[model samples]
Target chain A: MDEGRRPDDEKGEAEETAELLREYERQIMALPVQEHVERMLTTLSGLALQRLGIGEKEPAACSPQEARLAIDAFRALTEVLAQDEPERGGVYRATLAQMQLAFVSVAGGRAAGKGGAGATPETNGEDDGEAGKNGEGL
Target chain B: MDEGRRPDDEKGEAEETAELLREYERQIMALPVQEHVERMLTTLSGLALQRLGIGEKEPAACSPQEARLAIDAFRALTEVLAQDEPERGGVYRATLAQMQLAFVSVAGGRAAGKGGAGATPETNGEDDGEAGKNGEGL
Candidate 1:
């Protein structure tokens, strides 16, 4: 019986697997898509900070290109969220501002390191607070 | 005088703009690409945590799909870092494990909320310690 009638057992296993998949799909569909976008924004913000060496203490390791890319991605996504989820979008906008400020600070440090005034005229640490408040363009 | 001699002044301004751009390009080129990859992984890890609702106290906002996407992206980038920067790669691998564990724990919470045993049989708060230690696959 085991040798010749195994098709029924195989079919049962296949059905079980299909049922499991359906259940999984149902669970996934229950989650709000907005939550995913929020998570993505949070992640992109972290990436931007990392690119700027915010917590790493290695300003020399800062990558303006990567930080800019991450920030741009965050901004694009945030704009979409703003259209529908304005409240959450505003929160993300604040987060984006902070990341941009960090980028400027790090990039300024890089410029000073190379003995150049850099792109940002106000590269001094003294001016950072004001620059951030004023929303200086990147 | 203003009408006939504006071309030289305009040409000088264009040359200055070109010079500034060239300088900016040089600065961007100086940053290590490896640093960017590491930052990217760091960002992805944070995104996974956000998706898992780790910091938000809003487990209902958990999006397993987003969390899994972030984790996968982190893992893929980490593999590349491991090839050239083994030390940092190992650090990121450890970070990845923590994120995966968080994913399982949150997913378990969600399942429990739905009155199900969940994908992880050991969904209790106590088992989380060892489950994380054992590196349970997502």
Candidate 2:
């Protein structure tokens, strides 16, 4: 008897979303903790690549907003990686620097043409230099 | 018939190690994935703090090897979190950068004194700069 007969639809959609989130939690929990970590890193790398337009038809398939997020995600995780391992410290930074380069190569172009503020992955040069310095000291 | 009673002892030790690993896996799997990520980050922060002598009598409570493993775990989980959510880009970075700052404040001193290779939390200054640049463009 309701005008649109549709309040239930929205409720159902919300329920579906909740269920999907729960399912995701379950799938993630099913793996060993270390395994989960490995998978997540792999996923993040793939997402960064995709957003950068690595394999997609469009170069830089993601919006500038998405690029910023990818850049932040990459750096945050890289810092953690760099701090946690003394012997492997430089490896994660190197990987992150490369990813950031891929991101900057495309995002920088888009930002220039459209007048957007890009994440500026160019700083990795300094980071690499620092890592190299650290390596020599070690 | 046995001379030294050594085979049984080795077998028992191996069994104990396997059981411990299984228990660790089980404990990790009991929590939701998000909870796992949260705990991992917290652990990383605490470890960094301990290494920096923030709350403990000892400075560098963790060995470099231990730090490396912790870093790997943190980075892997963060990547997973970053890839999972589109709207929460800035949130994870904010959390991570803050922790890195905390790490830097303490670690910087120790690194300077001991001639140790630092974790490079100093980079966050430039990261903040980059984030600000991106924000203004938006």
For candidate 1, list the clashing residue pairs, or say none: none
In model 1, what is the error at residue B56, expressed in angstroms?
2.1
Q: Residue pairs in steric clash, candidate 2?
A: A84-B67, A84-B68, A85-B68
Tens digit of per-residue lDDT, candidate 1, span B1-138: 467879889789889979998998555544444554555566667667766777866565456655665675576556655654589778988998898878777765555665454334354343232233233334
lDDT of 2 by residue, A28-55 (tens): 5433333434454554565566655667
- Which candidate leads the pack in DockQ? 2
Query: Candidate 1 — which residues are off by over 4 angstroms?
Result: A1-138, B1-30, B57-61, B118-137
DockQ-derived CAPRI band for the predicted complex in model 2: incorrect
Which residue segments of model 2 deviate by more than 4 Å?
A1-35, A58-61, A116-138, B1-138
- Span of 10 residues, lowest total lDDT, candidate 2 chain B: B129-138
Candidate with the greatest TM-score versus the true structure:
1
Every model's TM-score = 0.36, 0.35
Residue B87's lDDT in candidate 1: 90
- The deviation in Å at residue A13 for candidate 1 is 66
Candidate 2 per-residue lDDT over residues B23-116, each given as its tens digit: 9865554333345456656656555344434556643242332333344455444665655454553565665566555544443444444443
- What is the Å distance of residue B32 in model 1 from its true position? 1.3
